[model samples]
Target: MKKNFYHLVTATLLTVVLAGFSSCGEGKADQQAAASQTPSLPVISLPVKTLTGYQSYPARIEGVINAEVYAKISGYITDVAVDEGQKVRKGQVLFRLETQSLNQDAAAAKANVNAAQVEVDKLKPLVEKNIISEVQLETAKAKLKQAESAYNSIAANIGYGTIKSPVDGYVGAINLRAGSLVSPSSQTPLTTVSEIDKVYAYFAMNEKEYLNFIMAADGGVRDEKIENLPQVTLILANGEEYPQQGTIETVNSQVNENTGSVNFRAVFDNPQRLLTNGNSATLRVPKTYTDVVVVPIESTLERQGSTYVYQLDADNKATATEITVKDEINNLYIVSDGISKGDRIVAKGIQNLRGTTTIQPQETPFDSIAAPIKKSFR
Candidate 1:
């Protein structure tokens, strides 16, 4: 009976050992399945769309002609006829100088002229009465002519005290005021009269762009290409678009050695006289792109100065790829390299993934995924 009890206990211990092994094996299998699964991420496909890209550059707005109004004679300003920002006409008197000294000099010159005329009149009668020689009368007449010329020159100098506007336009910064001493050699101008009925927008591009203009044009000659170029738009300093459109009027033939850029001038109409000289602005040149690869701007990332996008392979593994951006539209980036049409890329949620991460792609529309997310307010 004791031998039978021992056999039964040994069989129970064996059964318990086998069950423990089975339980451990099943737990390991479940852990492996969970570890192999990768989280899914939203993705989008690159599309080929006809988009117009704009290349903008820093620009300056100037009047067609900016004329400096200067003092013509040296004297204290007695009257400032126009104020700053006032409209003026060509040849309109802008300032009056105190010309009391010039007036005194002119008065002295006029008296000399009268005395010389009296002497000439006296000599002519003497010659006619045979009381003096013809040579004497002729010498007196020459003196009279010289005196008249001197008087006229002095009178003209006195008239120069009144400064006039050189052009018909609006007045800019008036530095001189009543009782201010001015001169012909003064460094500062009395004011600037800018002819702003029309304005010129000046801008520049680098040497690479200058060559591109010659190469990308669709004409046989350079002149023909310039003529066929499209009109450009002006962005005002106030972040508003200028009412009138501008044409690319003149392009510098050679690049500027100092600046390493080529200058371009555009002209716009300012009938309302809104644009002023020395105003800052930007120039936007629209370029049309066709059959080009484009991706939403949100899909791109920048790493250490290089722009990148997470590209997916056939196996759904994400690879951090670099791309060259040609230009930008409203919400899309016109890519020049590193991506093409039908290429699948991570649309959003890239911060959570790493290089070569396996992702289950949840395909989403580009617009819906690319729209700027609005933050909710408390």
Candidate 2:
């Protein structure tokens, strides 16, 4: 009985060992299949190109001429000829005040003047014949002058009741409506008129920028004949580029001591009247960097504290290439080191990749993913 039990136990052990070996083989096969099925990293080819250096800052749209129309004399407003946003020309009548009192005063003055003229006519013969005292004739002449002066004063006051536009512009908010009392000393404005045909954009830059610009001008680095800087771009509030270009018309003589910035003003021709006063915009200023290689910003990758990019090799493997970024111009980054002209650098998909990774490269057109640029260089 003991011998039979030992044989059965031996047979069970062999079968268990065989099952374990088979299971191990199957696990290895599965692992091999998974390894073979793993997808490869995608490859992208980017071209090397030269780019201009530019600086962008927030700017605002301003009308070259902004005016506030106010009442010149004290009276009740009877007529308002223009509404808000109404375009007007110079000398156009904006509002008319009640002039009944002035008119009545002028009529009374005219009656007095007529009476004085008759007295003067009657006294002229007396004075010429020496029948009346010289003092009596002088009194008549003085009365005629006083009446004429009163009539002229009333006429001038009546003219002041009609308010006219000082410039050709578009009307702004109407502070006073018809039948409202207005006066020369009133704090309320009747309305505002802004000239939009040619508008001004005002902005401020730091002292460093101001000094650099001055140095460039003085050193002949920029065109010496250019008294006013040409070609300024206007970006609208909605981040849209304005079709019209502007010129730098004025620069402040002194920089602000507290802000350390200098004020600048640019003038733009606004034929469409699209830009309004106080609308914010961005000003794109052109600058140049020397001896630098610029590449698409996407080509760079950050790892730890260092920046890198993938460079392709003959075996279709990507090696991490460390780069030193100098500055960013638009969508491109200027590299001071670690990249050269004609070197193919990966433009996208650098996040999920590493050194010595194999890839299948596909060439993409540079212009398709390139950043939007200005139509012409300044």
Candidate 3:
């Protein structure tokens, strides 16, 4: 009995030791599993950055002056003086009409004038001798004046046959070539002359956008507002920016009922003749936020119409906090309220994060988080 009792005590003690070891192991495993659940996320303190945002719109480009070259008289084109795309000066002859018929008519009119002058000369001596009445000499003088007027009228028409450029510009497509019939009443013009030293970019904004733009400008009157407006930029069709800056020159007062938009005109100097009539581009108006608190857009979450960010506490616990976004720049948000500079927030990868989750905070530089944005924004 004593031997059995000692064995029983020994077995019980051994069993207790084994159970304590197993319990300790499980406690350590549980702690390790819990630690694994916490995610190591990149976090950054909010930064004050100057952000430039663009309001872009489709624009139609036109030269400073687009004039149509037309004929003032009916004739067949005998000679084309200028080629298409040729630069021409004002009063340069663009086309010459056939003047053979006009010249023949002018010769006949000159003969009639000579005949009238002969009759006037013969009657003058006869009237002085009283061989004919004064009425005969007066009639001959009237006929002479009439003949001269007819010749002058034909001369004017001959001059009109030569079509000249009214403005100094580059010639567009020539609709009429040699032997092509042209007339003053024709619907089509001989060609177009475009003065493209400067170009105009015409764009439109909706009523709401126009209201905001005018209200933000620092002026009471519309003209003053235009003068105070910031310079605009032109984005070419190939996704390149134009070298020259543009100024907002005119804004339409009435909104179009069909489109519900207000028209704006910006002028850009085109010294290189890069822009011309009928070209298309995009107009970019910049709105700059100076020294504002900005946050990475990826770190923001939209829930129920409110924007929120995962703000990190001193213990690295992430809490969902609402933020007021005044404007959005490239891959960043301009925070107006609910967050301040120097506040720590998750830099990125906040999609799967839940409320009040403890995270292993990894410090990330602000520029590092925003480098990609700056690189690709342009």
Top candidate, metric lDDT: 3
* Full ranking by lDDT: 3, 1, 2
- lDDT score for residue 135 of model 3: 99
lDDT of 2 by residue, 1-378 (tens): 999999999999999999999999999999888767443543445445555555666777767889988887899999999998899999999999999988999999999999999998998888889999888978998999999999999999999899999999999888998899999998878887899998888888899987766675533533452363547787677877899888877788788999999988888999999988778888866655665566666777877988898887777667899989876766666788887866665667777675677666666655545566333232
Candidate 3 segments exceeding 4 Å error: 1-27, 112-146, 373-378
Per residue, candidate 3 scores C-alpha lDDT tens digits across 1-378 of: 999999999999999999999999999999999999999999999889876788899999988999998888889999999998899999999999988898999999999999999999999989999999999999999999999999998988899988899999999999879999888899999999999999999999999999999889988888899999999998899999899999999999999999999999999999999998889998899888899999888789999999999998889899999999998878888899999999999888888898799999899998788766551223
lDDT of 1 by residue, 1-378 (tens): 999999999999999999999989999999777656776789898878776666788889889989988877899999999988899899999999988988898899899999999998888878999999999988988998888999998888788988899889999999979989999999999999999888999999999987886578678888888887778888887888888889888889998999999999999999988889999888888778888888787788988887889999999999999999887777677799998889999998887777788888999987686554221111
Better candidate by TM-score, 2 or 3:
3
Q: Count steric clashes of candidate 1.
A: 0
**Candidate number achieving the greatest TM-score relative to the actual structure:** 3
Q: How does candidate 3 fare on TM-score?
A: 0.85
Estimated TM-score for each candidate: 0.77, 0.69, 0.85
Model 1 alpha-carbon drift over 4 Å, by segment:
1-36, 119-138, 217-221, 301-324, 337-339, 349-359, 371-378
- In Å, residue 82's CA in model 3 sits off its true spot by 0.9
